[model samples]
Target chain A: MIHAIRARIKQGHRTTRYPDEPMTLPERFRGYPRLDAGACQDGCTKCAEACPFGAISCKPSLSLDMGKCLFCTNCIEACPKGAITFTNDGRLAANTRDGLVVGPDTERVLARALDNKMLSLFGRSMKFREVSAGGCNACEADTNVLSTIGWDLGRFGISFVASPRHADGLWVTGPVSGNMLEALRLTYEAIPAPKLVVACGACAINGGPYIGSPDVCDGVDWTLPVDLYIPGCPPHPLTILDGLLRLLGRIPEK
Target chain B: MTSTMRTFRNGSALPLGDVPVLETESFLKAILDATVHGWRVSSYFGLPRGGGLRIYCLMSSDSRGSLGMAAADVAGNAFPSIAEFCPQIQMFEREVAEQFGVVFEDSPWPKPVRFERRLTDRTAAGCRTGRPSDVGVMEYYQVKGHEVHEVAVGPVHAGIIEPGHFRFQCYGEQVLHLEISLGYQHRGVERLVLGGPHPASLHQMETVAGDTTIGHGLAYAMVIEALSGTMAPARAHALRGVALELERLANHTGDLGAIAGDVGYLPTASFCGRIRGDFLNMTAELCGSRFGRGMVVPGGVGFDCGPELAETLLKKSAAARTDLANAVELLWETPSVMARLENTGPLTAEAARELGLVGPAARACGVNMDVRRDHTFGIYSMAQIPVATASTGDVHARTLVRWLEAEKSLYFIDEQLRHLPGGACMGKSNGLAGEHIAVALTEGWRGEVCHVAVTDDAGRFARYKVVDPSFHNWPGLAMALRGQQISDFPLCNKSFNLSYCGFDL
Candidate 1:
């Protein structure tokens, strides 16, 4: 125990001071994507064709759906016109589903916190029940990491409860598959009324890479009414925490 | 013995027509003989041929460092079950039957491998036979006694982990039998990868079991490169090796921490948890994603390591290594942690070998089998790390083996980074050779990850089989739980940490 204490003391304060202080992300960290429609050559469908998931649509203007994007930057490489680039900003979560869509003119898409009425109920404390429906476990793993001492999600009054009965909302990850659809619905129903559904990662919002697979239901929006969409193949813990904080009105909307 | 089966080296693509197609009886005899003579079945699956199924078995001769492939065409809807002679092939046979509707005549424990609903729907493209039962609603082994009781634990667990059903028949606190039923995380990964290296194939491979992204990604990349008759650059191989070892370091650290947590040891649990994140952050530094998702591509790695980044990695890994040693030493020294781990969930070497266990679980049982050493590939062929093992075959053995391996992995990363080859991290991959079969094995942090891809005449994948180590080790976990305390199930389960989705797939 003494040795552990000594080790802990030596590795002092590993936790990131996010919300209160800015977190330093790596240089290559792919986050919110920026689109330049004018840079695209007329009638070129390179970016759309390059996307593993149909996250990009060329014919209807160069729009990148952050919800479906894996943040793999495959489109950026395939786009000879340099039409799409990812900004290092990790705050890509949004309150509405349509808000996740990034057009050429859109500079940034920030997650708006809940309305004043909803905030009053869940603003101070929000416990979530995480249900992984056909998720790859990446999103789930990242979410669990938030509970670690470094992230200390409990510090923000956001905790993942074991039982749905204790939850104020459902934090759903993965593309909802036919097998998990019933269980997911049952889990959502188990939560009390006036509950929120926060879909984390690209798979939950728009099926990410497993987009058109018949096995999956595309995203959680096909079943539950998603209140928040956190995008990434598996969004970093910082991104997930930022979204949850914004949802609970803990972090001020940018 | 070698004359009966055709042999090929690891990562070599053989012409589809070159594999010797033996008579059904002879094929069965050959597989049984190989297993009896110490060769293990690496992969066993069926491919569609002339509206029927052609069974292929890939056996690995670990000592010889060669792989054997044998094939047999099913005459009708049923094939003779070799699983009785070679118990290791039972699950593979069941999987083949579940997917292709081939009946294994008079086989013991014949049941659906994944209990997939689509496999029962006749309208489904690959539904050759069998009706889909409700997932996790199958007959389980029961212990009938005055005070015997059955405890059922989730397809939805209390912990923030993936879903899988565990049924334990216990008398008081002692477990008589544990049956693991998993299909909950099934997302038709194999079905999704059928036609071609579809745009989503690489991404699907990465998520086969999300934790082993680099492992599966490396295996799939090797499969593509093998089939295409190309090799990744030396620098690319080095980068892949770095990523793979980093993955091992992170996961091992986390598993050790989780094991400590399961036993109620908080210090190591908390400290190792943070250290695990440090390793993941190092990976994020490499490829911008914590899980190393976008780091590995087909031809080579997606990211490059320059001198400055290499120096940073070396420094960070050195720090993590020191921190991990300090944290994990506490688990070894503390008597409470030691008591909870030692002799709990003991899997004998005999049982482990018979069950065809792979990875650390097998190594913990003193089985000297590691894909990286046995089937050399990438930088592993150039630089070898000693395979760590323990004879106890308990939670402690698994824990110790992981720590030792993590130490080696850290050393490996430091060495590789300090002497990183200066060259392109990717190479040109031409179109795959048509009508060929390729097998690629990677020693993923968990265990051996095998990817076998067979191409059509048009250079597209006709059949792709992924054998996650969890497929071989989940049974070992079940066997370990026998005659043990029921409460230790979580500890035993963590020691293996088998992937439900990987197995379900």
Candidate 2:
């Protein structure tokens, strides 16, 4: 016990001061994509051609669906005109499905908090049950990282419940594989009424890399009525936390 | 026995016609002879050919540090099962049966590996059997005795983990049998990569098991490189080595913490948890994403590590090493933690060998096999990291082996960063050569990740096979559970921590 205490003391505090104080992520850390449609050379479709998933649409002015983007910067690299760039603005989440799509003129989409009813009910404490439909475990790992000492998501009274009965919503991850379809639905059904669904990661939002694969149901939107959409190949824990807080009206909307 | 077995180096791409496609009897005989003479089946899959299924077996001879490829045409959708003689190929046989409708005659537990939908549709050109059904609903081996209670847990588990069903047949508290039923996370990864290396193929490989992005990505890149006959730049090789080791460092650190958490050892659990993130952040510092996702690409790495970044990484890794040592040392010193880990979920060396377990799980049983050392490739061929092993095949042994391996990986990453080669990180990958079969192997944090690609006459992927270490070690996890307490299941499970999706894919 003494040794344990000493070790703890030697380690010191390792938690990040996010929301309270600005957290400085690595400069290379990719988050929201910034698109400059005016810069596109005439008849150039390099960005769209470069995208593994058809996340970028260039026929009409530049538009990128965050839900479909892997943030791999393939589009940026392929763009000969420098029309696309990834800004380290990790605050990319939304309440509606269509809101995740960024038009050329739109600066960025910030996740809006729930309406008055949900805000009053779940603003203080929101418990979620994470269901990994077919996630590669990256999203699941990042989601679990929220509970670690560094993140301490519990400070906001947000916690991942063991059972659906104890949850206010379902935190869905993965591409919702055909095999896991029934279980994922059953898990959502087990949650109490007035429950919200937060689709986490690119797979849960738009099937991510496995978008057109016949084995997956594309995203959680196909199964459940998602209340919030957090986008990333596997959304950073900070992004997930920010999204959750924004949904609860704990963090101010941009 | 060695005379008949055709051999190739680790990353060599051979003409498809050159691989010996012997008679069914000779193929089976060759495989059996090779196995008896100390070789292990690396990959076994079926490729559709002229309205028939061609079964290919890639065997690795660890002693010779060479790989052998052999094939046989399945006559009328049925082939004799060599699984009974060589238990290691049991899962592979089951996979071939399910995927291509080839019957493994007289094989034990001949059931669908991943109760996948559209097996008939996918295998329409070849032999087809087994209709799609609900996942995890299969005939499981039951224990029949007084007070033998059966407990089924998950396809939806309690923790924030991937889904898989675990059924325990217990006599009171002690488990008589434990059968793991997976396929919940199957997304048809193998079928998706057929025909050509689509723009999405690299991304698919990276997410084959999200945590194993570097390992799988490296294997896929090597596949493309071998087929295209393009070698990555020296700097790229050095960068890949760094990324692979960083991935190992992150995961092994996380697993150590998870093991501690399973045993309810809080201090080490909390500290290691944060420390694991520190390693991940170092990786993020390398290529942006914490998981090292976009870092590795075909022909070379996506990102370059310059001198300044290398210095930062070196310093961060040093601090992480200190933090990790301080945190994990608690696991060894704490008597309560040791009591839960030591001798819990023990699998004997013979069982591990028979099951063909890989990675730390195999090393825990003192099998002494690491692809980096045994089947050398890339930077590993130039600089070797010592394989760490422990005689006790218990949970403690697995934990200790991981700790030791993490230490070695830290040393490797530090060395590579200090002496990073100077050059362009990527080389131009040309169109693949026609009628070629290439095999690429990487030592992922979990174990040996093997990817084999057979190109058609048009230089497109005819058949691509991925063998994640989880495919081999999941059986070892089941074996480890035998005669152990049911309550200790989580700890034992954590000790192995096999990938469900990787196996499902």
TM-score (C-alpha) between model 1 and the true structure:
0.97
Task: Write candidate 2's Cα lDDT for A149-204 as tens digits.
Answer: 99998999989988999999999999988888888889999999999999999999
TM-score of chain A of each: 0.96, 0.97
lDDT of 1 at B279: 91
**What would the per-residue lDDT of candidate 1 be over residues B398-437, giving only the tens digit for each residue?**
9999999999998899989989888898899899999999
What digit string (tens of lDDT, one per residue) describes model 2 on residues B1-505?
A: 4566568999889988888888999999999988888788899998888889899999998888989988899999799998888989999999988887788889987977888753436543211112334788779999898888999999888999999998999999999999889999998898888887999999999999999999999999999999998989999998999999999999999999999999999998899889999988998998999989889888898888888899999999999999999999988999999999999999888888788888899999988899999999899988899999999999999999999999999999989998988879999889999899999999999999999999999999888999999999998999888889999999999999999999998
lDDT of each: 0.87, 0.89
Candidate 1 achieves a global lDDT of: 0.87
Off by over 4 Å in 2: B118-133
DockQ of each: 0.53, 0.60
Candidate 1's error at A185, in angstroms?
1.4
